[model samples]
Target: MRLRRARTIAAWALLIGSIIGWPVAAFGPARHEPQFVLGLSFLALIVESASLLTASQVHEETGSK
Candidate 1:
């Protein structure tokens, strides 16, 4: 349950961060901070992949189709 909740939160954070980060990195005063946004995007990708692998493990453990 805890893992599930954390994954949900991470997903939402990634979505919201991208929504706000892109604009800030593109046209806002933080135009020079695009690398920060890109780095975060890469981190989020890694986290999401990990979450997928974890889910697969859980499913296999439970013998679920």
Candidate 2:
């Protein structure tokens, strides 16, 4: 798959996982398990998105060398 599509899918998965996982973590009776994945996934997703955005912008400016 293309990098763009892969990144988009990953971002969505992480976004949704984080969202769903947050509620589960809060209302379920767990202190660490669900929240761990939720927080980490969200953080990784944000970083991935930022990196992808930066790469795209760089490529745009650099003529996709």
Candidate 3:
């Protein structure tokens, strides 16, 4: 239960971070630096992958199917 809850929270944080980070990196002040944008995008991708993994685990535990 605790592990699931922790994963859920981490997944949520990563998902939200990616959602907010992408725009900021693309259009915000950091846009001036190509490296920053690329780095942020990469980070967002990693976060998204992690979130997906956690979400899948949660779904499995819940026996959704």
User: Highest TM-score among the candidates is held by which one?
Assistant: 3
> CA lDDT of 43 in candidate 2?
74
Better of 1 and 2 by TM-score: 2
Q: Each candidate: RMSD to true structure?
A: 5.4, 5.1, 4.2
Structure candidate 2, residue pairs in collision: none
Q: What's the lDDT for all of these models?
A: 0.61, 0.61, 0.70
TM-score of each: 0.44, 0.46, 0.54
lDDT, residue 33, model 2: 60
With a 3 Å backbone cut-off (N, CA, C), the pairs that clash in candidate 1 are none
Which candidate gets the maximum lDDT versus the true structure?
A: 3
lDDT of 2 by residue, 7-56 (tens): 55665665566666656766676665667666686577667666655665
Name the TM-score of candidate 2: 0.46
Model 3 lDDT, full chain set = 0.70
> What lDDT is reached at residue 50 by model 2?
62
Candidate 1 minimal-lDDT segment of 10 residues: 56-65
